[model samples]
Target: MDYPYPKTERQAELIALADALAGPIAARAATVDREGVFPYQNFRELHAAGYLGITIPRTLGGLGADVLEYALAHERIARACGSTALAANMHCSLIGRIDETGMWPAELLERVNRDIVANGALLNSANSEPDLGSPSREGLPSTTAERTPRGWLINGRKRWASLAPALTHMLVLATVVDGDSPPRRGNFLVPASSPGVRVEATWDNLGMRGTASDDVIFTGVEVPRDALVPIDGSATPGDGLGWSAFGGAAVFLGIGQAARDAAVHYALERKPNGMAGPIAELQTIQHRIAAIELDLLQARTLLYTTAEWWVARPAERGANMWRLAAAKYVVTNAVIRATDEALRVAGSAGLALTSPLQRYFRDARTAIGQPPLEDVALTTIGKAALGLSPGGNRDGAANHDAAVPVATVRSV
Candidate 1:
């Protein structure tokens, strides 16, 4: 599991650490998936290994790694367990965004960094609602935060709350209501132990069951006025969605690589009843393996290249979002194709409960609906290629009213 690209000493070190933890994590993946339980033990290891604060700045007692390192480490972890990697991605992406964009207030940022560094506190954004769906779409949150005499009171039900089983804090998006003023969206930092915060067990799904991405109900959850982190509508120096897009791509690519490895191993060992040698000698098997490798090559190249470009060219990222979207689109679909081909290579054994390939297949399918889904990615790329703005109008005249802002929106 050598990294395919050049890396600094620090990046190599982090990747190696992730690889080291992957083996033990992979061993427990089967039971975690079977029982649909959260990988609490896996998180303990990750936290103890200092991966929980990998993205926070060094001054804040963290590794201060960038997006490339984050992507690389996540890929290694995902190669062992998609659920662990995906759930961790939620926490890492939030910290990554806060680090990349100096958007949060100094006190709030310091508090979050301290929690992660000192206590390995895990956090995630609660954005998607049952009715509003993904926040990436053009709709305001139905969740409301009213200004109270003492503080802000929040009330809403958020679905797909990943890491709900052990969240220390949740960045909740809610529409703010003030006296005689129009409603505005705000990102409120709500502690998990709030008086009215409750997690409902409703996350049984097709795959990634270990994520514990259940529903969280916030009823009259109160937070201080300082808890409200204002949303800046204007574009910033860093791309807010970079971590989500690249980190997610790496996870799926890792899953694809695992499938490819499984197929190769099985092919080299399985000898048919009448064959001269193992299935590795078969032309059809070789062709499928070739296809899997080709997909991996394409996906890795695009995903890593885009991530490097993002790190190298920060000032130009706002204009180059389509490239990030394209990487995600390509990696997810390539991984899915690779897994399907791997299953074909393994034949009946791939479908057995004892085989990890079936689990890989199910987990890979979950990547399709993550943020910047297929349709959304295609729409962004299509618009960019057609010389139109995000609003779908020509000549770069974007209709701000209709455009969806690129914020931190997570999926199950």
Candidate 2:
């Protein structure tokens, strides 16, 4: 069967749902950002609206929306509150991947989803390490999963773990010691209450403060065999991050549109001492606004087109590793420019803390440095398009340390 990324009907329904869920809480969620706190209640509301596990299986009491529809929903969420949207986006992607595994730890999955739906249980992935950056590549994990008679003993430090404060369960990716082939890398579901796992709750970032991204420490935390969500043999479309790529692009699209909306609104309202009327009516403002529209259109097209590609040939959708990066790069850069232009048009008042534009400017800047950092992304993308091998990113040396065997570690 052909994969429909975003059937029209699904889009319409998602848009309506997002409007209702995010509209009223937009202001409140932004306030949470200002207060440097988590948007707990806002996410609870979103969960109640079925946004928590919207991409999960229908048998699991979820919406089970398609990939494109999922992205559309994320965009709407982002437009309202960047932090809330980003936090929820992480969980949605994680759950979607877990659902693909189909080895849902019956009681664990239900409890986790229940917390997300009713108790605002946010789930996140602990992939980035303080010593070795992001570990999605072939990097050796410094975080070891030592084999013990009592399941697996994990001990590692994860940095820049977004949404940790609100997260009840986290999938920690680590390397396992074995007597056979090579040390196997896998992910395990760790509950917050699990012994030896604690959150630092000390993220004081410049943007997206409401994300509550903090350092998570694991000290001899033990997970039973059942807690491990093995990805070794998983070969489904969902297993390959099909929905996550599209979802990230969609959220960024929302952020870009939010800036666009602000600019438009400010144009009509702010009346400069121009030749005839309001600043929006001025030729200069009109021209810049038109450029913004072009940026938005182009970026949106890139995202939607990428989604379409994924749906058509899900297996050949590897381009997303870089394309999604580009989409995020373009959208954030576009929105940042749009926000700056809007501020310039608004003059002094736009820089004030009381103004939403100022907040957006700060928030948008944060996205640039996040996971798909523009610099690394473009480099990796260039290598891929040119048929060159991108063994690893800037963190190659660090990844080497994580994946390679140290001299001190003798063969067991």
lDDT of 1: 0.85
Rate residue 324 of model 2 by lDDT.
Answer: 54
Please tell me which predicted candidate would have the highest TM-score against the true structure.
1
Worst 10 residues of 1 by lDDT: 396-405
Q: What is the TM-score of each candidate against the true structure?
A: 0.94, 0.84
Clashes by residue pair, model 1: none
CA error at residue 410 for candidate 2, angstroms? 31
Query: Lowest lDDT 10-mer window, candidate 2?
Result: 403-412
lDDT of 2 by residue, 1-412 (tens): 0123346876778768988988876878668777888887887788778788787767767787767778877888888988887777778877776666556667877766666666656778887776665454447767877777878899998877777877788888788775565887777788878989889977887777788778889999988877667643554422436555667657666776777788788888876564466778778888878877887777777777776666566554433345555666676677677666666766777787777777777777776655455675676566545545332234322121111111000000
